[model samples]
Target: MGQDTKYIVGVDLGGTNIVSLLMNKRGEVLERDARLTLAKEGRERTISQITGSVSAVLEKGRELGISPDSLLGVGIGSPGPLNTKKGVIHFAPNLPGWREVPLVEILTQKLSMPVFLENDANAAALGEWWKGAGRNTSNLVLFTLGTGIGGGIIIDGEVFHGAWDTAAEVGHIIIHEEGLLCNCGTRGCLEAYASATGVVRRTVKAIKEGRETILTDWVQNRLEDITCELVYKAAQKGDKLCSWIVEETARYLGVGIASIVNILNPEVVILAGGMIKAKDLLFKPVREYAKRYALKDAIEGVSIVPAELGDDAGAIGAAATVLKRKGLL
Candidate 1:
């Protein structure tokens, strides 16, 4: 391979920040940079911010005596729903006023290089499959349990973009016909019960309803102070409410994964995101639930694992997007 094909820039764009990394085929990060997205500044300015961040990274590479042409191009992982076919962002709730922005074309024009766009969760799944926990597996599913739950399914080393390029939304899979109200106007979507927000909601409600717990001591009825991290900490201290909340959330996650296993039969299921940082307290229960609920045969050889890429999963996956877009995979 030539030098140009040896390196790529990965861009992870979020509502709050934009993280860029220069990486090689083996997943080595050579240089990294970050900037606040300031998305409220409006679409045009946000695009400019993205453009400038890429430019600055390229310039930094040049200053290190790296030839500009040696760069493969840029891979962008952004919040969706996006039009991957046309490289346009369909609608990103985090970024206000962002609608139908032709992100890929604009960046290509500005940088004079090819650009590839993908949903952040899908990109993260690809990233893990390529260089992280899901390595050596042809089929896999990834669930990111953070402020929200995002999902991606990788089948045969490729992201499964269903009709209209919006597939594998496991987070929205209805685990309960009549459960918690979801942000999507539905009842009991997995995300509505399994996300950090969901966990905190459950914890706070328990406290408000007079269920005994240590969480109340932290902030009495201050819902804003209730978070997954706080719940994890409380659970660590043996808080009954926090512990029960986690176990309940894990049950929903297990149900969601069981459905994915029954449908996709992937080789592995990857769990990533801030909430997973709870480690054994969260993971052990999730694995137990999956083993108990998932199809006996479908999960026979399946492995439930934690993601190795951590916070950089999206950025690295964005870089992988460049490779897949170029037909390198």
Candidate 2:
């Protein structure tokens, strides 16, 4: 590597997997590595996995003739309720026994380089804003719709951490008062309706209540076998009950997005995660309902689109955090 060339490593830490990337300031990814997180094994094991991931990436960089000095640092996108300013993860529900872990300090000490941390969703939003669907806009909102909903807000080219670094908890936005209970122990949260888990939960409940659907037959009366993707497939096959569920999920998402639009007026709203695989089946209804509910001016010119980065967004965005902090992005 040239003396003037520099690089950074970004790690996306999840309960199931850890993805790490070696990237340059120019947004070029040079080497990538992935491994299981083994979160249930305990905090010490998970931390070792994280450090091992970084080491693997750095070793790969060495093989590419990249000097260790050219590597600036590592950035981690972690599940939180974390204190980014202090680099402490207060608690992570998915990671057993992860409480007040000084991750940045630990990783910095282990790697002998600066380490930065951000909420995973926020890192993904930064990734999209920098190189994915929201690349053209400085202000954006991103919703990752998987087992649960996660969100990030980007304002004027930066993640909006708000006063306490938890400003954009979009999933918990109350879309339906007195509605379904959410995993977060809240009532009527958007996550309780639109998330993949929420969708499957509602579907299973409706089936048990004797609502007719192809999903029941497909699952051979095993309601537990039904999934959000299976629900979408049934809906696409013209199952009336499944169709209604999909539409209801889309409407709930639209309602949430409309509320966000009214308040933030973001340039673009990007939807990511597994549910996006439904594509037009999901986007069409969501866009329509958002237009129906949002203030006319607020809805105008705001684009709701799918994210482009896919699985790589979290790691790329994590790296972007490092670059942004280093004044190199």
Best by lDDT: 2
The parts of candidate 1 lying over 4 Å away from their true place are: 1-5
lDDT tens digits, residue span 94-151, model 2: 9999999999998899889999999999999999999899997989999999988999
Q: Report clash pairs, candidate 2.
A: none
Worst 10 residues of 1 by lDDT: 1-10
C-alpha TM-scores of all predictions:
0.96, 0.98
Tens-place lDDT per residue, model 1, 1-329, is: 46445778899999998988887766777778889898989988888888888887777877777677778789999998998889999899999998888999999998898899999999999989988999999999999987778998999989999988889788899998899999889998998999988988888788778898777678775767887898999998998888888898888898899888999999999999888778899888888898889889997888888999988888999998988888876
Structural RMSD, model 1: 1.5
> Could you give me the TM-score of model 2 versus the true structure?
0.98
Q: Which stretches of candidate 2 lie over 4 Å from their true place?
A: 1-4
Candidate that scores best on TM-score: 2
**Relative to the true structure, how large is the alpha-carbon lDDT of every model?**
0.87, 0.93
